[model samples]
Target: MTSSPAAEDGVVRADVWLWAARMYKTRSIARQAIDGGKVDLNGHAVKPARSVRAGDVFELTRGNERIEVRVLAVSERRGPAPDAALLYVETERSIARRQAEVALRRQHAGAPRPPGRPDKQDRRLLQRLKKSIRD
Candidate 1:
């Protein structure tokens, strides 16, 4: 197999790095995220082809979670989870914030929900509440 450009140089494309690091499932998805402005390098939005080097900081949002990582190595080939883990280090602040957000979600998720569809009386109350808000 042909070696990737990153094998020769110390830099790799941002999208490729993201996929290789397991941040995104595939390179195309990583490219899409970059194009959508969901990925940033050194605190600024970067294109998929942007060159990423060791020690560069990347902040990206994947679904509801925001992740920040510092690049430790560069690779273009997608690897195992453990290998991917070696590519970057998530900042401690990022880990703390993610944990806090997860805890908040867990707290809200503990709220009891109705077991089934709303009863007629419950639906009526909801309709009245909606009408009042529109008025």
Candidate 2:
């Protein structure tokens, strides 16, 4: 695994650090979220290039989960899962909220789902109906 550019300085770019920590699968995606305001530092939105160091706090939202974590270590390298886990400490409140959200989703798991993929004819019919209504 290669280390990030800023790893030698004891700080890393927020996007790089987030990817390194396993918060997002890719640095580009993390940068996009940061640009879209889905992640914040100390309650204010931050740029993807913002530097992150140990003890910095982050609030990241993805789908139904909002995580608040304090940076425990800054590493530029994308390491193993266990090592990645050591990068940040999640807040207790954040943990509790995630658990509650998981439980709520589990309760809805029995809801009905569509039978299968819509066929080409069904797609054509839907398109015609939508066009007719719009016209």
Candidate 3:
């Protein structure tokens, strides 16, 4: 299937676009992820050069989780503070669900590890760390 050509101004790498869009933290990580088949656009796997347009839906997988995001604009380079925000939009529902999960996980993550057999040294370290964290 033929896709539309990239904007005449310039075509940016898909990975770069994702990073600039704040979908990913770093361009290299984005490219590695794409090359590793961790990224998809409109249900189709894409290389790093595939042109990105507004309203593009991308499914990205990292570790054991996958995320769906929509594009709002494309830029050849990462834009400045305000302009950078014109990049992509994570659906509200997606945001809510993800935030909820993160909140729940964080709640548990911050809890003390199950009280099991902790040797004297282990217990002391755990206590110190927990105390430090509390402080």
lDDT of 1 at 48: 91
Give per-residue lDDT, candidate 2, residue 102. 91
Per-residue lDDT of model 1, residues 32-83, tens digit only? 9999999999999899989999999999999999999999999988989999
Mind giving the per-residue lDDT tens digits that candidate 2 earns over 21-129? 9999999999999999999998888998898989899999987689999999998778899999999999999999999989999999999987888799989999999
Best by lDDT: 1
Task: Estimate the TM-score of every prediction.
Answer: 0.92, 0.74, 0.65
Best by TM-score: 1
| Decoy 2 TM-score against native | 0.74
Would you give me the overall lDDT of model 1?
A: 0.94
Model 3 stretches with alpha carbons more than 4 Å out: 1-6, 9-11, 62-66, 114-117, 120-135
Evaluated at residue 3, the lDDT of candidate 3 is 30
**Model 1 spans with C-alpha error above 4 angstroms:** none
Residue 90 error, candidate 1, Å? 0.5
